[model samples]
Target: MSRHIDLAVIGAGPAGARAALEAAHRGLSVTLLDEQPKPGGQVWRAKSAAILDAPPTPETEAGNRLRQSVQDSRVTHLGEARVWQIERAEDGWKLHVLRDGRSSPLRARALVIATGAREFVQPVPGWSTPGVLGLAGATALFKQDLALPGQRTIVSGTGPLVFFVAAEIRRLGGAVAAVITPNSRGDWLRVLPGMLQRPDLLARGVSWVADLMLAGVPIHWRHAVSAVDGGSAVEAVSFRKLGADWTPTGEARRMSADSLCLGNGLIPTVEAAQLAGVELEHCPELGGWVPRHGEDGTTGVPGLFLCGDGAGIRGAAAAEIHGRLAGLSAAQHLGADTRAERARLHPGYVRAARFGMAMTALSTPRAGLAQLTTEDTIVCRCESLTRAAIAAEIAGGANSTNAVKSGLRAGMGACGGKFCQTAVARMIAKAEGRAESDVPPPTARPPLRPVPVAALAGDFDYFDLPIPRPAPL
Candidate 1:
């Protein structure tokens, strides 16, 4: 008998974990599907025994709470499962899921998507160096295995995340070459007022800054990484200070570093959303193309809702509250009484989300970052397509990002464009002399996360499947 879930929450991140707990608390049988082997999302991904042998931080503690709730609650937590497709069923929805080289169907009355975000790595020369890792990858490596990408690394990017990662790397006993940020002092001052809106967040940033300072790590302000240098792995890096327009203002500074952590900001992972036939709009401030949803996480499609970074890049605080909102709203729609929950928490979620938007606006990358991409710089590292190749496609009458993808195969790689789509769109926008929004993101299709063809074509054993209970007891 196929297991039927009342509400299914995708992802195991802060949003998904909280959403599962909230729905379960409201007397709903929820099945939380996560791709990770463990419960914590990327931000709070569990540490190995060696790493966890040390004490935990508040974030870890919070993650433990959510993990415990999901573990202790009746929520059916399915790890290492990839939800490939969602289709309309007679009663509600049928999700095509692939796991352990087999496919199965999961029926659900309602679905909550909290798949979270992917890093928008700013492409630079030699970025494909062996030692280079995305900001999120760096964090995951540290959290999962206490693995530092390099001995001496340059943690450089456009936002506050770089600072946080740099501090964490140091705490993990990794050496830092420098922390490079493209934002000038003036730009930070502009957001200083908005940062104060959430004193807690502001204090966190202040503390990261202090830790760097105390550790004698140099922070290069108003600078952007120009290139990574190495024959195989990262050996050194070059960066230049930028002006208001993001143009290089001075000579490039070169330094030695074994590894480089790169990211401009986070992009919402919307493949699952797109597969659900959810409408998406390009909103740069919220991290590229995002699924259309309301304050209560209601998508245009009934019985489907979205929350967390998958909905937008509002950080962890906003993600938690939004997850709660989406959960309670979904529960209320399912005939559960959550008015008190929504009434009490909705306002705070909106308030915190506003501040997050403000921060995203302040850190929203400017057009000047594209200037670093020379003809030889590899834009689509997955396919080895250089900036010139994509530009040539543009010159050959490729009008949209999809057209470029078709003609140039920039996104036709194992990564499936997660790393190249934004960069490709920006480059196309520049070449066409149009706004980036003019080029829509490449359409996310079925088999969203790459799966082996055999997995999709194969079936699992029915005999081993557990018999369905009458209903949630």
Candidate 2:
């Protein structure tokens, strides 16, 4: 038996939650799916029982409100369900969902994808060490298991996340050995136009700055992490004065720490969109390749919609607006009048988007970041493929991402290239002597995620699966 829904939403993040609420209110049978066991996505990740419950931050407050709405609106919340394949169907879509090692087919009249985003890390030497963690990864450990990465940690990277990560470590009584960022105080001035308009963000920034200063936590701006030290675990971190060219200039400084928490920025998650044949373009301002979408989250596909960071790299607030718009648009498609609701969200969307553009301007990763990879630096976490190996492939006429993957097997890992494709694509661009945007990301294949053989044994047959035709743009 196939489960049928009027609307099938992928992801339980701010976007998908709001989308589900919107459609459900319009009297649609909605099923909201997420791979996580809980409702909140990354931004509002639900904590485990062992951890001391955190008081609701603004993010959690808003997230809980929307999540509560979804729960009360008769929307089906499918937690711990992963959709690995989506094929064209007679009605709308046939989604292959895997849960607890069993695969089932779901038929949906409409689809909403809000897969969210992940941290973008610079590949530096020794990052493969056990204690090294991405900024978001560290947050997940703290939130999910109430676990700390190390007793002593160094938080380094760009973007506002560096500030938050450092504060969290300090709050946990973990020694924040140092905080480093490539952007300097002067860089803040460069994006003043955008920051000035966002007074709410400004006030919060002031509070965080004061608290960190009062706690005696040293913040080293205009500095970038040059390397991570120690054999099996992070023992030290090396830094150099930030330069326009990303060269290790002046005296290199070292800080001792058991763990390195680092992330420069975030990249949108668009695997689901790409697998559905939605068009994507590389936009550095929006944190690399994002699905081409409209204000209402309309994509190239007629019945499929996109929202949140998966569509662009906007923050939580902006994502909320996008989600609502998408939900309302979806409702309108179902023959419900949503004129007033769309009107209400449009202004907030515009206002937040201005701030978002400024954020992009202020926190854009420097081009010099591409040079962070050295011969020994690991590019693919799954295969342990080295920069040298990828470069060797690129030099040998592997000018495209697919070519490099074919030769070096960098993206043929458990991650399916999500963890490494950006860096690998950049390496290809550098080797091919072309622009980063020119080297396109590798194509995505079905089994978008790993699946169990038992899950597909009697319920599904790959050979019987029909090819999905692209929807009209």
lDDT of 2 by residue, 124-179 (tens): 88888889999988878766665778998889887677787787777667888888
What TM-score fits each model? Answer: 0.94, 0.93
Residue pairs clashing in model 2 are none
lDDT of each: 0.84, 0.82
| Per-candidate RMSD, Å | 6.9, 6.3
